[model samples]
Target: MTKNKIEKIFKILSKQISNPKTELTYKNPYTFLVSVVLSAQATDKSVNASTVKLFKIIKRPEEMIKLGETKLKKYIKTIGLYNSKAKNIINLSKILFEKHNGKIPSDFNLLTSLPGVGNKTASVYQNEILNIPRVAVDTHVFRVSNRIGLVKTKNPDETQIKLESIIPKKWLKSAHHLLILHGRYTCKSQKPLCGDCVVYKHCSYIKSEQNKKNISSQ
Candidate 1:
């Protein structure tokens, strides 16, 4: 897509949901990192519900290690992959304490090296916390970007690369949230709300549907 079109798409999305931010409730970077780890293949609502009580008591890495993996799993049992995620969280917390002095590292490589902190998680932490312009392509981003003709990629990594290359730097910071919200609410996987979508005009999915309708009518 062209620079102007990309800007228009994001501007409209931003207007719809002003000050778009992560739905995961957390007190600090430590909690945010844990939430992202728990959010793998899980919903933000689920993560928030799980973290609500947990965050009140144990909001730091050292505290998490003290909580132990078993207790951590019990706290996040509602989320998917609770057992493995709990282990990763505990292991990562130990690393945070031993290496970074319980602070979340700003470096992407260092962040990814942590257990459960994949590319998507690292990008999310960087974007929200560090204000880095990294497009974290989750399922929503993958579907929405392709549907909107923003990128014609196969996987999340490809989508991320294409998005970072094409999307204007000005919109990069907010693009992750904008695209994610648009996909989650408007451009859904099963039945998209095309009529209600603000960027329907620019959506290739809508255009394709129109073409099909025209062909059928003809």
Candidate 2:
């Protein structure tokens, strides 16, 4: 898509989504990182459900390390892959406590070096906690960007790279949350609510479907 169209789409999205932010609940950076880590294959709602009580007790890496893996499992057991998520959270907490003096690293590479933090997780942490402009391509972002023709990519990594490069700098900070909210509520994988979508006119998926319907009618 052209830059002008992309800008218009984002402008409409920005207007529609007045407050574009992460839904995951956390009190501090440590809890936010843990929330992001636990949210790998889980929904933000699920992560928040499990972390509600857990965050009250564990605010820092040292506190999380003290909680240990076995006890941590009990807290987040409702989430998918909880066993591995617990282990990684505990291990990463330990690393943070020992190496970084119990503070989440501002460096992207340092954050990615943690046990469960990958490209998406690290990008999210940087964008949210460190005030960085990063398009963390989760399932929602990947699907929405492609469907909108903002990017034509095969994988999340490629999608992230392209989105970060193409999205306007002014909108880059909130783009991640904007796209996620759009996908979660409107441009869903099954039976998308195209009629209610703010960017419906700019969506490649909608345009293609309309073309198909017109062809069929003829």
What would the per-residue lDDT of candidate 2 be over residues 119-160, giving only the tens digit for each residue? 999999999999899999999999999988999999999999
What's the lDDT for residue 217 in model 2?
A: 100
Off by over 4 Å in 2: none
The residue pairs in collision within model 2 are none
C-alpha TM-scores of all predictions: 0.97, 0.98
Put down candidate 1 lDDT per residue, 1-218, tens digits, no spaces. 78899888888888998987888898988999888889999999999998999999998899999999888888888888899999899999999999999899999999999999999999999999999999999999999999999999999999999999999888899999989988888889999999899998888888898999999999
**Each candidate: RMSD to true structure?**
1.1, 0.9
* lDDT value, residue 164 of candidate 2: 91
lDDT measured at residue 4 in model 2 versus the true structure, 0 to 100: 92
Show the lowest summed lDDT stretch of 10 residues, model 2. 198-207
> Distance (Å) between predicted and true CA of 151, model 1?
0.5
